[model samples]
Target: MYLSSVSRPASADPPTPGRPGRRFALVSGNVVALGTVSLITDVSAEMVAAVLPLYLVLGLQLSPVAFGVLDGVHAGATALLRVVGGFVADRFRRRKLVAGVGYALSAVAKLGLLLAGRSVPVIGAVIAVDRLGKGVRTAPRDALITLSTPPESLGRAFGVHRAMDSFGAFLGPLAALAVLLAVGQSYDAVFVTSFCIAALAVVILVLFVRERPEGGPPDTPDGPKVSVREALGLLRDRPARRLVLAAALLGLATIGDGFVYLLLQRREDLGLRWFPLLAVGTSLAYLVLAAPLGVLADRVGRLPVVIGGYLALGATYLLLSGPVHGWPVLALTLALYGGFYAATDGVLIALAGPVLPARVRTTGIALVQSGQAMAYLVSSVLFGLAWQLWGPENAVRAAAVAVAVVLLGTVPLLASPSRLVTRKVPR
Candidate 1:
């Protein structure tokens, strides 16, 4: 229903006095506060994520098929709820409250796992609950960031936020490992510690984060009050609609990260002992590059950066099927994979920030995210089936091809209609 005022970088309003060159200062305090919340929450969440598979498959001796189904549920069960959460937040104008509820739900779910004992169904439910919290909080939390920062610096703001988030992800497994060693590998100890950490995150959110008022004075109207219908109607806008579809299409071409690591192990015939290190390498790369990439996206252009990230992903797929051997392949592929994440993860949302109205921002973002998540679910299944039917090499090459085609198609869909979309593509 609305368009960003500028189609190119030069037309953008100059940064407010004392703002443009000041990266951290230009970023809103809300972003840093949320980033801290994410860092702590991710550590708690990741601590469990790092150990849950081992506890389920090895300790409980569940079949691979059962684990696969549970894994898919864990990853995808929250997709639709994301829209619900976003809509609720916008409708009530209570984003912080909605996000807080999500955080509390996740914190409590950590304790639920401890009570679930060895029961498979109970454990599955607990995991689902935890994921639901993640889904619910994500859109509102990101919406807060967009509301807090200037539109021009959205990329850099998201970058710093993601960097902090990635840092937590990097620390999570390590924290789990330390807890395990400290408590003789007791899963209950890890769960309790995770709950404590998550609870602390909730406390930080309540104490530090401030919510925008429901409506301002007569002289200053906050955009129209958002309704569920208006939120959904965001799709009526051409640019927004294209962004949603393009995100889903791009996501369809992406198989999950685990598959990439597994392929690397299979290709190199790497030892079981080194399997975990593959993830570590990728995380290292992501942590190192996320912030810089964000700044680059802000400076260069978000669309090009996003496309470049996907290109990095396609290249990673190609390298997996390439003739390269030994450590070089491992290092290069992992770096490219990390680059892919750095480029697209937050950048995509940052790209979407200006396209949709502030009134329905959370809902619009949730729509884009839900599409990607659903497509990712289908993509993972399709890739697995392809691997079985055509073998890993063929399956991977097909993925690379799909990524190339999607990238080409997406460029035009995302292009601004006014002109050649120079330094900053239109919102």
Candidate 2:
């Protein structure tokens, strides 16, 4: 088995009684480097995400159902590849290299958008390619964080990392808006610029991020080899199985960001130019709350934090369909939406990190993520169908109800006593 020590800075102070030592000790240099990479990469990814709904729905004149299919594809196109990437990273012990390849692929896909030139199928293909990169990178990248951080600090470490990532998400829409205004609403310019930024992120990953921290277990030929059977066997582990099931349930309750923003736009009659800013509001809230909520997860419990996040999601959907009008609804919905992401995104992974063994940690993370992605694909399509059959208002209200039902169902799965224990993989 591959064993590793948590990477802490030499300057880190030991925890003292009555001191805020946990706060200071939670993040390490390796985590910061990873966060920086995510920060830049999200800026590139979100720029496209911010504008794509409008481009597809209004610019391309696609129906809600078509957009939903495309959106679902965008989210889940490479779900299986998440497992492949994780297995590759674990088997080769080349996490950074795998993640870098994923980033580079996403960067190149931005240029693919330029070549697609308004063909719906071609655009869908490009979006799938872009999401493939994300699916490929996410597990290995998250595993790197889990490997480097102490089990106790996983929540805070992921929190800090996500906050930085959310900062990039926060800036991306503004950047897109600026480019669109400067270039006279030319999406090609936005695509070109996004490509450049994503390329820069790949460079940073290659230069700054380490495959594993120093003084940890070296990647050696003699280490126990990971196997496909072992990866599949993760489901036999009760905690891992529950986590994956819970993740899928949560994912099934979520409609994609595009639908939420588009609904907000239609309800408010917002101008086309203001649409990108809707993402900014959510990202801003996520950026501010991610770290704090992460720390809260560590102090309280991961399950509660995750449950709270789902509650926020439920509230956000209700606000969308509620009778309340004007800026208050928008602001509240965005804030709740952001809180939903902040509380759940990294925290759920952190919840899993401790329970998984070191030997196939990446594979375990990939399973959880893949389950969610696959379920999200279904949710998006169903939501689109609902929007078409029943109006947006009725569809959103149904979604809120679904969220509540899922939350009630998931609580028992995640709250089981066997779910949170840290596993000690034999060496």
Candidate 3:
């Protein structure tokens, strides 16, 4: 498939001077293959995500605090495993294999959800298993993209991948809605269909995605083994440390998509059936903006783009809490939320890709991702508490303030030009 078609070597090739299209033109076939895998996987994942909030809050009658805990667990359940997955992939030079395992685990977890029924603990456990699969797969998958693409075009590469991924996200909720409508609100059918689609994604990964693209990062059989100490040593680098800290801070400022959508649904008094469409709105905006913003990040510098994303996030939170009513608020909030994701998600990883050593690249990415996930867990819980204590409006407003504070704090951490420079970690 795509693996055989790309004849060009994958070594970092600086964009030709004055070539306007060089940035995206440099994105490799391997990146596209990986993106396809992510696209399929997201379709499977987002199907569950689209309906989960309503299932837990409305069907199960969970309080905000209980829902918060489950949501936090959903995000952070595999934080430690991400590092393990990354280290294993790096050590064995089997990124594709590790990623496949994670994918399979998540595909099976879909069935677990079917078995869990209405039991909260069981549902939480299933969610954790699903998230664990995500945690395991994410870093290695992103590392593969970085390894496949040139440093100069990393932004475009990740952007292209995320855009494809968002396209699937855009489709997923619609698919779920269709399933629900067809089967008379049968979540089981959605789960089964999701598993089938997820299984297909795994098959695609095994067949189409190359373990190592031609001229990609060195992972020769004779190369020195990647060690735990070496993985930990990534933090010793100033730029890498700052990047991870910045990522965690950014995560801390953010709340879950479920919360945002739920808040909107409450404020707008949207019907239960229309809930899934809210995610579709966000994903549609994400699909449209992801690639353009990525290209912009490469051109203007990633930090500014990332900062702007957080600004969009703050605006989204404000809109949720603000007095603005009717469809305009919903449209603007969803757009800004989607823009926030488009601006930050892949771009931050692309920014970090150039800073870490090739051998520990997956581990480095995992560390960054793990930190962010852990913080996201805390953020979700805190936001939940805020909602319970201060009510939704005050809670969302506080979240907006938090975003502003974190953005200000992040600027100084990332302000040093040297903080983003590529560095070699000694053996």
Candidate 4:
């Protein structure tokens, strides 16, 4: 259905011959606003994301294969939107406006989950809307983050932004866990809470965040210099190429946490409530590590940070595949999983911005994100099918093997930013 639409301010039509960069809130303001929304949204999302597999499997009796099919379809649904998001962001040049719409779409996704009936496919469709919002917003959002910051400190800016963004991730699941404790463990409570948070994110973004006037530097050598084809063509650089390739491979091998939770549930050994709590452990670890890891990336290099994240995540997949049983194993694995997300997700976005123009920055992020989501789409389906065909450990093992292979292949190509990507200045 339709969300309450927001009208965006006019595109930066050459900034009217010298409208000063008005010492606005873009850098700090945008980050803070985005963080607030993220925190609220995460409170909603983590509630759902944390226990979605349980909803699919035990609550609905869907097989691992069916879950995979659903996950794949959900991820792929988002894939349809990135090109549109990028093209729209570039064409209308209304990055902030497009972003507002994205947040609303994500918020609505949670509502869909609550309405979903007993049918497995309906649930998948609900998840699909949720993820499509992710696809749409991601590019435009990153593009705005880039627009908000000073050129030299893009890494630091994005990192701090990431750290703040992840704070919500930490709280969201805890809120859900609280819901489970207080309101009783039903899907409706989590879904409605998540939807509320998503709506709150929209309100915060709309009111507090502002756009830089048009003809903004790097976005324009004079004015939006690059064509869509040229923007897409920039990925031809070796580092961009490697990063996307590595991202795609990682995506192919990687399984979402939802699938992992299902595996835990499928074993029939753990308490029903344990999964969300374990998810809390994961989100908390991610929140704790996000800032520190982001700082480490700024100090050492994004490549090292990113590579380490991949290795750690690959190992986590291996661990989940192994005989480590009970809450202890689950707890540690969840923590590492969060750490993996904390380390890589933002840093990669940081890495991406400098490599692309302000105009096309979102598109670049969209492209890689789209790739990863595509991998998720493919991996979930394949992984679920394998789990059904063989078993959970075997399915996980197969994913781990793919991860290990890609990691070894990409490590040699890693390089520092000065060499890897070209830096741009707002003209």
Each model's lDDT:
0.78, 0.85, 0.85, 0.69
For model 4 the local lDDT of residue 330 reads: 71
What's the C-alpha lDDT at position 322 in model 3? 86
Clashes of 2: 0
Candidate that beats the other on TM-score, 1 or 2, i.e. the better one: 2
In terms of lDDT, the best-performing candidate is: 2
**Candidate 4 overall Cα lDDT vs. reference?**
0.69
Per-residue lDDT for 1-427 in model 1, tens only? 1122213223222323544444446466778899999999988987887677667766898754466456656766688999899999888778899999999999999999999999999998998899789888988998888777766677878888988887887787788878777878688998999999999999999998868621110111255676667877878866678878888888788877656876787889876444546666776788888888887777777777888899999999999988888898889999999889888999889888766666677898888888787777777767767776788889899999989998987877777565323345232
The digit string of per-residue lDDT tens for model 3 on 199-274 reads: 9999999889998785444445477898888778888877678878988898899889999999999999999999
* Count of clashes, each model: 0, 0, 0, 5
Give lDDT tens digits, candidate 4, residues 1-427. 0001111112221222353554232345666676666667677777787777777777888878787888787676577588678768876777778888878888998888777867666787777778778778778877777666543344555666666666776677677778878888777888888888789788988888766633233355356444768666747755556656666766776777788666656553777777776677677777788767766665556767777788788878788788667767777777778888887887777766655545666677787777778878888888888888988888788887887787777655444333354323222
The lDDT, on a scale of 0 to 1, for candidate 3 is 0.85
How accurate locally is residue 195 in candidate 1, as Cα lDDT from 0 to 100?
98
Q: Which residue segments of model 4 deviate by more than 4 Å?
A: 1-27, 213-218, 221-226, 235-239, 265-268, 412-427
Worst 10 residues of 3 by lDDT: 1-10
> TM-score for every candidate vs. truth?
0.85, 0.92, 0.93, 0.85
RMSD of each: 4.5, 5.5, 5.8, 7.1
In model 3, state the lDDT of residue 272.
93
